[model samples]
Target: MPDSGEVQAVKASNPGDSQVRVYAVAPRENADPDEIVDGFLEAMTSDDPGFATARKYLTRKAVRAWKPEESISVLTNAPDRDQADRPADESKGRTYPLSGRQIATVDASHAYQPNAPGEYNQSIHVVQQPSADGKSKEWRIDSLPKGLVLGEADFLRNYRSVNKYYFASGENWVVADPVYIRQRQDPVTRMDPVAQTVKALLEGPTGWLDPAVDSRFPSGTQLAPGVTTLVTDDQSTLKVPLNAKADRVSAVACKGMAAQLLFTLGDLTSVRVEQVEIQGSKGDRLCLLGKAQARDEYAPVRNAGHSENPYFVDEHGKLMTLSVGGRQPDRPTEVPGPFGKGVVPLKAVAVDREESHAAGVVQEGRELRVGSITADEELPPAVVTSSGVRPADRLSAPSWDGRGDLWVADRNPVKPRLWMVPGGQGERIEVSTPWLRDGARVESLRVSADGVRIALLVTKDHHTTLQIGRVERTFTDDGQTVAVTDLENAAPRLSSVTSVSWAGPSRLVVVGTEAGGVQQVRYVQTDGSTSATSVLPGLNGVDAVAAPYGEQAPVVADSGNDGIVRLVPGANWQPVVKSGGSPVYPG
Candidate 1:
């Protein structure tokens, strides 16, 4: 049978906070899904990894917010957050997004396109609506099983512009986002006798669920995220915290190992191990590195052309293409199917390792290099729900100059410098940006194939400026040049601006900073003619083309804050990878 599990959601309280959590949960037996949800939230909010919780259901469309005054792009007469009551002179296309909502569930789901032979497009959706007060919400996650794992997504924001781009840098030149990480999802717990009693009854870590001695709640014990047990007292199973053995494997090190592509293989079912492949570290079979851990799960057959799969192949031939390591890319793996509906390796990378190597470094320091996926393979429902990896960072946002090679901002955290890694194996030249800082951030970028034209986004100039420029270097001089540029007063800008693809040879694809679909088309000849619906907008950011997949134009995309992505049924547009929580399985 395939690896299948169930998810459910319930309502609960977080002591002082009035927010209600609709937790997405899955536990073996005699366990509270709520606790697991709470545990996951705690992990996201905390700095220490070892002492936190383990949650596999990070949603695909990462939740976001657009503060009151921060979302205006063309505010001929925009009002401040403190003074807005629907004034008249505001631009119709310039409305700000609400804040404060997040994913309520990240579970698995499946579908069978009869004649087409394809699994359901199992991506995560952050269902949002107006709260009683009018703040935003990413999603309200709750563990729900099978088809119960579904929700309708409404509204999509495509924040795009033409004049500039913003690109945020990552650690060790591995470009990624730093400042705007969302707060964790755990409800706060107060120290009191009732709460303490419930904590003691959890049967977690070292707690024993002995039938003869245990006097705690049965399977129906209340946990966070609003879940209760359907199988209340079949048999009491002890819930050991994920790191009970140790705080070894986590996202941080996993992210590192993801960049470096290290670790060994093991069964993904149980017995969590430490992932380690240090250059000369001692051998410990029990502990494997994070990326390495993901690599071990990539064993599959003819399942051709999967993009989301993480394939592991070390710099050395120590591991080769179709190797477990290659399958686990910069992102952790996800596997979903009827029976096998749990996290698994990204078989896409497993099948396309050599393709990635042809690009550049898949793992180096805190970065993972990934190439475009063009395979026509069918992925398991289990394999489709990996959402925690957002490529809008420095490592992922290399400029697409209409050619094979790419240019990276190399936003390294430790060393504030940029790098130019070719899409293929060439040389990694460190660009000079002596004035950059850890938080300066690269938002978006684009350069000619030969490294000529350039445009990008980054909060520079004392972290208040968003600039767009052209490249002067030809894969030399560290890719530093912005021939013609412009800057605008910063608003809720993009995470990066690689969305600036080529509309045609003459014109370009410009995205936006927020998740809105307000794109205006200007001419490419510099004559600046306007084309309605025929020409896409140029410039801007993360929310630019909300449901971003590829550069194939004349496609309807559901991007922006509203979390909707759509392409024609079989319109040749690439598919998107959604997050998973608990999916229904006939297994």
Candidate 2:
């Protein structure tokens, strides 16, 4: 409360009195009751910003007045030059503990002075305040653990969370973040205040005491959640999840999905993902097409599949397939296929556009030959509007589950056997399907919505068989799969299946071949119930089969085509794609 004039007067008359004993702040008699001042002193132990220099000097309570430029930072204005040498234990006054308590009324009279706009010091006039009990005083500054320093910055550079400044003799004390900045950037300064201030103080101490110098250090530890990483120029950054336990480590980039790592290990570094399968969010299934040795790391998913219409299945279980390779796929887009007179070719229907399906007709287009219905016309459909299970495109046509979107698979128009569904658009996941490059005949296909699970049926040489596949993926990227089983024991039946539709999940309609002289229609249910009805003389129904193996040859097995012609014998025979008429097994 001393005015500027008084302060000047006191300073002029006491050239030698401008010094005070930092240790004399022990006990004082009740010489002037109303003139007493007292408060607490916080003792900090960590190098955190808030407590950077607080523990170096005899720090005063929050209410204590402080002056950083004093002879001793903890001591205020001055008493007498002689007091500088007094022993700290001289019993100069009564003291009390104020470390973890709230205290008030710590006054500065030659003993303490204001150092800055918002700070305090230890060389303060202390007076004990009444405790809540109102009997004896409890909060006091004398009871603090002795030998602790109340620090002050010699030259604070910036008031950053971590006090980056010079102290003691101009050495540096950069109170840095222990857990946070540890993985961030290396500290530019040290935390030993006295040692930090020595160099600067010895040079020109006034520069160390400039008002513009900041004194705040990094104030926190792993105290809260935040993104504390140093982003690099080469598309690299430390992605640390705040809530993560103290020691978990992980590395990820635009390369692919997030990968797990050694927990006890320190900060994360980039890693190459061996393989990975991605699950689409909600109802969308993921499809990563083509073997992209490095395509999994694409930033926005690279869709390089040619215009062969990919079967698309929306979230609502709708299926659609389109024709792709019209010309070079860039010119006028088209759904291409062989469409000629006297040609009973397999037709492609957009499983997605059920309403627009060409019910019964044969037309020739510049790109694709929109095919016609089987001339039998006697085949009554359960749902005519949904159209037949013909793939309209050449893109890898994976079998449909009626739910998930398109999964990357193999598409051979020359050996079009199985049917497939389409895919929808959105924040989609990608799963690249692994097909055996054995070149074997693929008979059928199935996939999980996650795009990581698959089932394939293939034929080896002349043997009929089934193969299964499962894909495994973790984090944001790694994925791979293995075939589970290959069954070659099943016998050949009549005509190929009219359809392979899944019903009530985990179950499908095993539509048997159509019935003729030797071909017969058959249907098998998951409950072990099967039915067969002969609608034709020798042309029995046929079931489409899927074969697995990239190196194996394509097989066109079919139910026998032993039907009769009432009129013309040559034109009476029906052509069923590449599926030949094999003898229909009665078993």
Candidate 3:
């Protein structure tokens, strides 16, 4: 061991130079009108606190009236700058046009929609103004669009998503209420992200998600007064202190309150809250146990189930499963059923959540049939519905809801409608889709896991689009099944959708070509408020896609050349079966 003085001398000789260098760039100080426009646009990407630096390039009047959070345009690439009109005098005001293909647009509620083609361009008007120093005239933006524009990559980098927990219809389980958050909203230092997530949870669900989900917090419940930060005790336990209002609820409701916080905080990658201790404003612990607890302690009430793996029909029209990690016995093994034997080629197929039953459309695209996967003998599939319409306007692939109901679209031009086969056994029941516009046909539809929502791919005026709506089940006075109401087009901007599937509790994975011509797999929140980054870079002829419920479950798709492609972690798309089409996961 070296002496204190020797250690100091050694430290001096071998300095630990692992210091981080933060190069702070000063805001642009140019006075040229063109330069001012450029600087203003550049500063928008900075995400500066309140956009302080970007305001420097704006006139006082314009800055006061502008609202940055009004909207955001996600462009395919950087804006193309052009001089709209040249002023005769260099010092006079002029306008510059910045145009780009917008892939998506986000509203104030953070809901993302695809912007209509040719409607995403921006026009900036810059004028001469007296500088703050009062020494010289400078060019500053006087009038501009209401929203900010950024490249897709930059937009994804600055925004993130966190799901707030809410009670489902029965309150027997909890569902996720996804909401967008700035990437930096959660602090990195002294601020606890787990605490911040809880605060967001206390705010309740967003407008769109509220009607579909419910909260368990008491009417006036809130965080403890005068406490803005979340405190954690030793052993990584989270101490959540609630107001006096929380005490008004029953013991069961209090447990639900604890569950909501635990699920929301656990979802954050930045924080690992193993145990949560719920306390009252007076520091008295609430609910049963009155001690720190783990997520497993509350798993009985969470939506902890996931969907079964995906199954697909091979090029030869044999139903098979891709052996992932030996989850399935035979690699690309033909399923044990009539459809699996290749007697009747299938166009599209869907399996029930229990994996015991399946529904499919025959190759002719006119007949929809249902069969059992657990049947040992080669039994004939029962035909549920058959359409006499043209192939292009005939029956689409089948979808299974959580209730084991089979849903399919009958796009007969003269009588376009949606039909459901109760448990794949009873007669076909025609469901009313009144919200579908005139001449718009349902190309495809998939029901969410909870069976409360449905995503429809509608084709109107030759444009294929995706929409979502509430699934209102109506019954006769005697409790007999009647008409099913579809509140369609929940995600209006997911245009030209080729295929889609529920990828999470409240999120859907959509594959489509945006207005900008970028075709890839993207995730959209069920509320239609935000569109996340593409799940996979791009695939050739992604005719169909399917995903299970969990976060890390394998996503399979039917594509050309590569046949069946599976999305593995880190890797984008890898061939699974080598040749298959129309993939479907258990609903």
Candidate 4:
């Protein structure tokens, strides 16, 4: 008989924040049908290596057909098991229905895709079969759903999210591709977390990011045969041994591959990977890269070291800066530009990544002006203008891309369009957005640092939702044609999204509400997944939210009741300015 330890109560924690492991036991001899079903479900949530114990409760045929790794369905809570409507006939079979509210799913690629809460119902059919001794009978599950089913708590406990780095298409900068990996050793591959992350990097980017990024590893490249564990040496260097496919690469490509490993393994806090050394199939060194070198050469947006101070429009409708670091300033200071000098009243403003220039919406949202922040230059002529009569129907807050380009949406319902201003001063180019052709209008917009993704607050059918679209630019003889394509919902759980900003390469901070729920602020991945710790403390009447690229930077927001406030981890929202609005971080 296998040890039948009781299943522990589930405790919610951030993904990758917990290290406790749950062990699963094999089914007891002659277990009844209900017990068999219960044990099977519990086993799926355990750290049982290879799920060998879980398979013991399944019939031989069922074991052959079940593919636990095909996908994972995460429910809001543990599924409820109840007897099916059909009569229980021991010889024929017994059926138990499993029901729950699904919250998200982890596909085969380990990409987490969250959906609005929805009902989930499935069945497990069990039948009595002869024991190994051919003298007794035992209950065994004969049919069940494909893949594994786990509650949100158990899923977070077992698996943790890790960012696998890949280079942006044709760019030296790296982009984060977040995916979940086992917190402990993987049950199926028996590989540790470090090794698992490395393998994931070699497998390439997920489906949603595939078109916008490229992996440095060669095709068919993989860890050497039978190598399932990776660790750092005393110098904090992780040596990755690759198969023959990656044995011969140029110096540049090798560095790119090393940079990917460095960032991916660096996300795992348990491992201190200061350096990464790539090894070829013949055990020869291909390339080596240090953490500092990788950051200087191919750093992600967060590591780019942009200014951390947040900017906001003060009560006087002028751009001001607030320092949220250790020592608070006496009060926010005006920027060194016409918009900051109050030459013209401003509604919204976005500072470039280098903090040298800013773009603002002036003239009651009818005009967008860009000016230098280092000099008190006159606001340039409107790079773009809208004919909409109402301020709400005109221009959105401008956003600066990492490439020094500016993006904004003309909310004029008559001719709604997305526009990009090259160098923040060139002639505005209309970007095509077919999805918005159906009468949807953009309420607000934020461009990612990679210059390839844009987060838009789109309103349609009297409802507003957050959508992420890919910015595809094609060079034509006439010039360059740009289009925003492949839009995906970034926050489906939120019935209405009022504000959004890029918090990280793959994460966005959004202000929205669930169906019939109160307004709230939360962190959402670009892919729409949310972690348990994603929600911040409650704040009332939040109109705009801004998150700096740096992880340690405080999140600033414009609250109607509290004015400008900032939220730091482990602390409540504190007031920054009593009469400020439209807080933003340098894009």
**TM-score pick, better of 1 and 4:** 4
Q: TM-scores for all candidates? A: 0.28, 0.22, 0.75, 0.95
Q: What is the C-alpha RMSD of each candidate to the true structure, in Å?
A: 27.4, 31.8, 9.6, 4.6
lDDT of 3: 0.69
lDDT of 2 by residue, 1-587 (tens): 75565333343322221122122232233323212322123222123333323322322453143332222222222121111233365335443212211111112111111221222322432334554467755323322323222322201111111111211111111111001111112122332321122112112212212221222111121211332232222322223222212222222221211111111011122222233222222212222112243333221112222221222221222222222223221211112221112232323222211111221112210012122222212322211111223443232223322132333232343432232222332222433333333545454445522232244445446443323333333333442222222221111232233333222111222434323533332222222222222122333334332211111211112333421111111222233222222111000
Taking all chains together, the TM-score of candidate 1 against the true structure is 0.28
Model 1 residue runs over 4 Å out of place are 1-365, 370-396, 400-403, 433-439, 461-466, 474-499, 513-553, 556-587
lDDT of 4 by residue, 1-587 (tens): 75898878975533533666667878888777888999999999988888999999999999999988889999888888997555655588888999999988899999988888899999999888999999999889999988999888888888888889888888898888889999888899999999999998999999988888888899999999888999999999999999999988999999999999988887898899999999999999999999999988887454456548899998888989888865453489998878788888889999998889999899899999998878988777899999998999999999999888999999999989999999999988999998886789999999999887899999999899999888778877888888888888889889999999999778899999999999999999887877888999999999999998878878999999789998877888989899989899988
Q: How close is candidate 2 to the true structure, as a TM-score?
A: 0.22
Sort order, lDDT high to low: 4, 3, 1, 2
Residue 191, candidate 3: Cα error in Å is: 7.7
**Which stretches of model 4 miss by more than 4 angstroms?**
1-17, 85-89, 300-303
Full-model lDDT for every candidate: 0.27, 0.25, 0.69, 0.88
Write model 1 residue lDDT over 466-525, tens digit each, in one string.
Answer: 243433333346553322222222222232232343332124444432234444322221
For model 2, the local distance difference test gives 0.25
Clashing pairs in 4: none
